[model samples]
Structure formats: structure tokens, C-alpha cells
Target: MLKAQQSTEMERLLMAWILLQNFDVQVSRFVDLISFLMADCRYQQMMKWIGNIHETLSQLFIDASPLDHTTCRMAL
Candidate 1:
């Protein structure tokens, strides 16, 4: 049951990231989602998934266009 709840929260966080235009909020929301997921004892085994998302976010900044580079880096 707890796993289901955490999964839902994580989904909501990702949706919030996608729907929201503010990069700062997206990063913060993801971080909070990761923190919450980490708090779950059973999900500690899934830490790699959280790490992957963080890595993806980092890559997203690097892949962004030059004009958005400063904006993305500043948000990170």
C-alpha cells in the first residue's frame, strides 16, 4: 500500500514538472520527489531509478540550445 502511494506521488511530481513552465519548480519538485522516495525503506533498492532521473535532468541542461543554456544551468 505504501508503495502504491509513493508511486502516485512520484507520478504527480513528474506531471507537475511537465505541466509547469518554471524550471526552478521542476527541479525542486523532482528533488523533493526523490527525497520522499528515498525515505521509503522498501524502495531503497530503487535508488538507481532516482539517480537516473537526476542524471537525465543534468543531460537535459547540457542538451538545451545555447540561448537557454544560461537559464537551464542557473536553474540547476
Candidate 2:
């Protein structure tokens, strides 16, 4: 009977270890996914800022007179 009890305990311990390993893998995957999403979000925000700057510059060029354009070119 004692041997049977020991065997059962060993089985339970093995099962628990396996479950913990699986949990660790799942947590690692979740962390990786979150990191990828955060990077993508940052990339999208940078693109939006670039678009806004381009639009503003386009408008500036359109509205500027010839003298202003000459001045701008010289400044550049």
C-alpha cells in the first residue's frame, strides 16, 4: 500500500511539472505577441506623423510666392 501511494504521488508530481512547462511556453508566446503589437503600433504612429509633415510642407510650397520660394531654396 505504501508503494502504491508513492507511485501515485510521483505521477501527480510529473503531471504538475508538465503542466507548468506548458504554462511557461504559453506565457512566453503571449509576451512575444504583445511586444510585436507594441512595435507595430509605434511604427504606425511614426508613419502618421510623417504623412502630416509632408502635407504641411506641400501646402507651404503651394501657398508661397516666388520670392518666398527663392528664399526657401536658399535656406535649404
Return the top candidate by lDDT: 1
Error at 47, model 2, angstroms? 0.4
Candidate 1: residue 67 Cα off by (Å): 8.5
lDDT of 2 by residue, 30-57 (tens): 3343343334432476446545544544
RMSD, one per candidate, in order: 5.9, 24.4
* CA lDDT of each prediction against the hidden true structure: 0.59, 0.45
**Between which residue pairs do clashes occur in model 2?**
none
lDDT string, candidate 1, 1-76, tens digits:
9779888867755664563345545455555655665554255546666666656665675677634646565655
Looking at candidate 1, the ten consecutive residues that score lowest on lDDT are 19-28
Q: Which portions of model 2 show Cα errors greater than 4 Å?
A: 1-42, 69-76
Clashing pairs in 1: none
TM-score of each: 0.38, 0.33
Residue 39 lDDT (model 1): 58
The prediction achieving the highest TM-score against the true structure is: 1
